[model samples]
Target: MVAIEFPLPRTTVPPKTGPILPDVLRSEWDKLRTVRSTYWTLFAAAATMIGLSAILCGIYVAQYAHLSAKDRALFDPASFSLTGSFLAQLAIGVLGVLVITSEYGSGMIRSTFAAVPQRLTVLAAKAAVFAAVTLVVTTAASLAAFSVGQMILSSKGIGVGLGAPGVLRTVIGTGLYLAVLGLLALSLGTIIRKTAGAIAAVFGLVLVLPTIAGLLPGSLSSVQKFLPSNAGLALVTGSHAGKTVPSLAPWIGFGVFCLYAVAALAVAGVILVRRDA
Candidate 1:
């Protein structure tokens, strides 16, 4: 039998082995930990939240005499002002977007895909890592902001306790909302694959559109109720947002926001699975 001649490959190679899921997760954890921005973002989240809270708490208590009777009776000012998360969420959303966008920006995504082969696994692992880390940190920041803020308020004789009805919901809800919103931004990053665009999308959703919606004529201000960020604000306030916006009960508004986040993440997952890295 004549031997068939074949072109030899240039380099000798051994068969590659794929990583187990646990190993992949550990690798991802290491990657997240090693990033300098991770620490900075966490610090900023805590600082901005606590700092704003302290400042607001001082103002509210010091100016107690200037406030109206209705403001004194219904205000959860401790929770309201301490919920710096309304702005701090920008940091969280940016962190989430960077989870995927950083790799794409730096050309590391190809290596990540090569190591995992199943690209979906990589995205899932990243989400798992991101959500886990964010939930813990955001929860801690929420608690710390609330505690410190209330201490200042109480010193001035104006604050509520967690045991008070609806207070716990506002504190915990802030954490949950931030975590979900971050994941939503992460999904957009996957879909858009560009950092600037992903950030703009988040800002547009949370800020620009809500302001624009309010500026429109009658019932459009009512229409702003459906927007995700504004909807989330309703979860914390027992009266302020409740009186003006078309809010469902607090938990119900949160549920609607959850639906928005999940749908965006699902669409991104499908695209990530089908697309080339």
Candidate 2:
């Protein structure tokens, strides 16, 4: 007798999940928060701003009497305190690059793409989460540094209030600058997919290029204002006193700086979509 084979029961797969930007956002937020580098980098950035500002302001407090007229004229309590922002930018920028590159290095990117499938959405989520975090931390740090610096200056009878001209703008600008700077690094990391190279590219654009540009003729010095770092610094400082070259207005310079980051991210997006993981 021939036995008839029974048909196997069909298993229904729950339909694959639909696109949920918020879910992608939550997943990215979790990834960012779980990483040790996130905390360490944020701490370093804040500490540098607070510690360095205190020292600089303290020195000014001690030397106020002996400071030359030119020195006093060049001094900006807000700008001086936020000077640590320069160093902080380096830390955050490196952290941003690491945020993306670390995944590539550890082969986690494949898993990330496997889960998300939409590569651009993954990058956008990473960017939105990272940008929000950096903005909060850096903005708070900048404000604290400004407050501490101003308090020190107050002891010397030279402190200015938050309501003072450009004071608030400068403080807020520090955070904006850093947030965009980090975005730029993330974009570069996506394009290069290497930590060291991305970091080098960021610093070279922010720090090295300015120095190189300075070597050019004074007439071309105006061109330096377009560089990411210089434009950003101009936006935050809002002053050109004692400078050999003039910078654009605070908002204008910031707009220019943002364009640089936007350009890089736009390119990264195209590459991410068109190229293989």
Best by TM-score: 2
lDDT of 2 at 185: 95
Name the top lDDT candidate: 2
Question: Compared with the true structure, what per-residue lDDT tens digits does model 1 show for residues 77-107?
Answer: 5466556887788898888889889999998
TM-score of 1: 0.88
lDDT of each: 0.81, 0.89
lDDT of 1 at 71: 71
- For candidate 2, lDDT tens digit of each residue in 1-277? 9776678555688665776788899999999999899999999999999999999999989989998888888877788889899899999999899989999999999999998888889999999999999999999999999999998999978888889888889899999999999999999999999899999998998889999888878688778878888887787888536666668789988898889888989999999888888
